[model samples]
Each structure stands twice: as C-alpha cells, then as structure tokens.
Target: MARIKLSCERGRSIELDTARTALGCIDFQADFVLPEGRAGALGLPIEVLLAALPAAQRALSAAREAGMFVFFTRECYAPDLSDLNAFRRQYDVAIGSPGPLGRFLVKGERGTEVIADMRPRDGEPVIDKAGFSAFHQTTLDTVLRVRGIDTLLLMGYTTQCCVASTLRQAVDLGYACILLADACAAYDPADHEATVRVMYSEGDNFGWVSDSQRLADASQSIEH
Candidate 1:
C-alpha cells in the first residue's frame, strides 16, 4: 500500500456543487479487466489487474448521482487500430498478431465496447484516444467547454502512464482536476505511488487528490 507522506493530504466530505463537471476515464475495460472480456480481442490484454471493480463502480455511481457533468474516455482506435500512432501498432505486433485485444477495440467493433456493468448512459460521451491523453486527438475540450465543464474527476487504469498523462494535461488546459487516488489501478505498485507523489508535488494548484470513499461521500452529499 502507498502511504501518504505529504502533510497536505486532507480527507474531506464530497460536495458536487464545487465543480462544473466530472470526467471518468477508462474504468477497467473488460479487455483490460476481466478474463472473459478479452474473448475476442486482437492483442493480448492488459496485465496488473487491481481487482477493485466494485469500488470503482461505487465511485462512478457517486459521481453520477451528484448531478455532475459525468464524462468517460477510453483507448481505442478505428479499424485496424489505424487511428493509433505507429508506436501502438508496433506494440500490437509484439503482444501477438491476431490477438483478441489487438483485434478488439478496433473502433466501431463490439469488442471495443466499454465494460457492460459501467457503460455510460445515452447522454454520456466516450472520447476515443490513440495516444495516452484523451485530449491528444479527441475534441474532449470542445465538449467540456460546450457543457460548461471546468473541473474533472478522473479514475481508471495504468496510473503512471495514461492516467498521469491525462492529469497533467487536464491541469495544463486550465481545468480543475481531482483524482480519486484509490479509484485507479496501475501495473506496478511503485509506479502508482511514484505517479501520485509526482502529481502531489506539482502543488495544490494542480488539483486535489483523495481516496474513493472520500469522494463518494462527497458526491453523495453533493458536497465540495
């Protein structure tokens, strides 16, 4: 477990009114979460599962009920993963050609679908990204702007990579971002802690960070 060494880490109740929007990203895709999920994927699926699906759902539900402008994003390119950069293509080959994961998430394919239990509602939008950051190629910012969203609540997989990248950019773009420190999972424990420490060190201006339970209660209370 990653213990908090920073004195600034404060626990708070949830308050939804403090922000204009909340965004949740890549919540343990089946291709990346469950074994059965990768049944027909083209590439080998993700490793380093956190086995915390239930908690993630609760956090998501809290965000939704709080009436925040809930949003979601995931990694998937168009057919053949062509929308992905060349580096990802090379990754596909190494993971094994014709693998289920590689074949799935080929954009427009059923395999690329978000995990069933946590699928977004009709009103929610899913941003497709080839690279790590959801803002890299997608019009997420445009949607955020249109929706009058200025803050985001992010959670998901691979804490050190995509999650961290998303956090950094979200801050850079002038949006208030709160990361559910426990709601996310990563490939390595050290990497996870390192990422959190780095983000925390970035200072209070970057955003607030907390555990899923704190955020959940806050959301339930519609508290800030």
Candidate 2:
C-alpha cells in the first residue's frame, strides 16, 4: 500500500496514497484549452480553460517526481459522427463549422489532440473517451485496475461537465478521488464553484477538493 497523507479544509479532508494514486487529467485537448480552439468558438470562456493550465502542469510535475502514475484523457468522437450524442451534435451546430480544427471533436483532428504543453510524456497513458465521463465507453477502469490505482487526483477542462461526471463515476467505482479545484474550470464560474462545493461538502458525498499547490506539497512528502 502507498503511504497515505491527509489534506484537510473547511472541516473535511481527503487521503492521498502515493503508490495507489494517479493523476487523471480529463479533456485537456486543444479543442478545449486553446484560446482560438473549439471551446472559444462555442463561446465558452477560453480564459477559464486557460487559467487551469499552470496549476495542472505543476501537479503533473509533482506526481512525476513522486513516482505516481499519470493519465490524460481526450474526448474523441468518430469522424462519421456515429459516436457523438445529441448534445454534442447540437453543440457542434451551436459552435458553427469546425474551421481548421476539422468539424469539432472528430478523432485525428488537430483540435482533438491534447494541447502541446499538456502532452503526455513517455510511459504516460492517454485514454480516449467518447463521452463526458472518462469511464464511459473507455478503458480507463481497466487501466486503473491493472495499475492498482485506488485513488485519482483529477484536473482538466469543463469542471462541471467532464470533470464532475468522471469524479462521480470514480467514486461509485470505489476509487477515492481528489479534484484539483484550481486545476479544473468550466465555461461558467458559478458552475465551477457549485461543483467544487458539492465535492468539498462536509460528508464528502463525491470526493474532495484542493488546489494544485496543496496536492503537490502532499505528493512531495512521499519521498520518491
């Protein structure tokens, strides 16, 4: 078992276990992160997306130094749109044509690729998910099981959507998750705040919330 550390805030705390924990970055792809990317086209706050970048990078560095596993998820849909749900298709129409990004979330498109700064390093796993939840229609569960990752430290785009959805599923699947609140954002600040408040609730109904710096400090104590 990995050594466990506790992070407490506002009368709540989450345990962080080094060996059993992994940093799961959800949907940090160009479509969502870049200022001129798909998210901007949809009128989602590109600033909100960009704001989490530095914190995410810091967390990744800390996890790497601590010998923790890191996984990046990309929201990819089939080129033929077979994999897109009604909401996504509708979103595509709302965002107008995909422009140079190749029709929104279609796989193999530049917009669908992970952003340059957030790219996965050697040995890091990149999981392609077709829906809001990384666990939905993806091999994330299998990967985590095989690697023995009992806990997940989450970060990435659209806090109220993909991030929240994955966090909920992760809890149900019996994995302890800590949402890096400062490392995740949404199109709306209110949405982001509400999601964090729910996760950071007294009883920890879903998981816990912490900023990247706190998580990094906690990971640093593991003595890699």
Candidate 3:
C-alpha cells in the first residue's frame, strides 16, 4: 500500500491505501446541524455542519459507488439515561442540547433522526452507541468484522470527542482509518483543528486523517 503523506495541516497528507470497507458517519442529526434544531439558530458553528452536508453526501455516494459499506453511528441513550455513562451524564443537557441523555436524537426522536441530506441508503449500517467510542458498548467492531471490513472512512460531529475517540479505536483494532476532515465539524474551530493536528502528528497512535476530495477521488478509483 502506497501511503500518501500530506503536510501537518492535513494529517501530513498520509496516503493510506487499505482494504477499506465501511464509511462511518457520526452524529449527522438535525439538532446538531440544522437551524431548526435550536443550536444552529443560535449562531453556533456546530450549526454550520449543514454546510458540509453536500460534501459528506458526495463522499458517502462515492464510497457506496465503490461498493463499500456505509455505517451511521449516533449517541442515543435510553429514555431514563439507562445506557448513558458517567461522562455523558456528567452534565444536564436540556432536551435540545445535542446530548443523548439530557435530550437529543434518540432511537425514535425526530431530533435524533438522521438529517434528510444524508439519509442512509439501503443495506447501510445505522448503528447506535451511547458513549464517545462507537465500538465501546456497541456491536460496531463485530459487525464490521462480520462484513469483512478493514478500512474505515470516518465523518461526523464534535471532532475532538466522538470522532477522535473512534479514530483511536479504529487504529487500535488494526483497521485503517481515514478521517473526512472537511466533512466533519465541531462546536469550535479550535477543537476541530486540534483534533486533526493530533491525528496526523500523533500518527498511527490516533489513526490518519484525510480530506473529502481525496477520499472521493480514491473512492471513485476503487473497483468495488
């Protein structure tokens, strides 16, 4: 595999060609990205996530076109916070704060629903998680292995947390990981930039990060 390395600004442009399978789209919900979700309407850049919707969809399409698996993971706790851990339950998030316990896009909540822009295609994985790491309590890893998935193309919200956590685990599991930098957003630019810097500078310790276009190009060339 010819690994492409970019500058630090861009995960050092590490070119990793692996037997990639799934594309993990995290926290792509209305309350997190749309204006009507309360947060976006308040001028939060977390709301600006919708801006990346088109690119995310494009990347997803490309991955699908390449015959890879598409997976969606969300942080949805039980109604009584039964499934939530101390970290997520630390604060009392109101119903609309984008937190699963306090309030959020849960299993059947309209707010928890996947944004219309990035609807799940047929046969894609619509996974559910309660913590920062999707593989923690969920069947994500086993599911991926069952499908023979190796490489993971990650995209989602809150770059410093969920996305970063997932990246580290993916690498530790021996699965090649590629972060969709442009396709993902965070509550703040500082956090987003910090996460990306760590992924590249930290290198294999945290997994690799890549841009949407490069991933799209690679997806296009992949022979299913």
* Among all candidates shown, the one with the greatest lDDT: 2
lDDT of 3: 0.72
Using TM-score as the measure, the top candidate is 2
> Please, what are the lDDT tens digits per residue for candidate 1 over residues 116-216?
86788888888888777878988988988887777777888778877878888988999877777777777567787887777557355557777667656
Off-target runs (Cα >4 Å) in candidate 2 are 1-6, 41-43, 86-97
lDDT of 3 by residue, 80-144 (tens): 67776665567746533444222564566666777888889788777888777879788999899
TM per prediction: 0.80, 0.91, 0.83
Candidates arranged by lDDT, highest first: 2, 3, 1
Tens digits of per-residue lDDT, candidate 2, 67-146, equal 88999998887777777778867765633246557667778888888898888999898898888899998889999999
Query: What's the distance in Å from true for residue 34, model 1?
Result: 1.1
Candidate 1, poorest ten consecutive residues by summed lDDT? 1-10
Q: Rank the candidate models, highest TM-score first.
A: 2, 3, 1
The C-alpha lDDT values of all candidates are 0.65, 0.82, 0.72
Candidate 3's C-alpha runs over 4 A off are: 1-19, 41-43, 95-105, 202-204, 222-224
Clash numbers, per candidate: 19, 0, 10
- Model 1, position 119, has a per-residue lDDT of 86
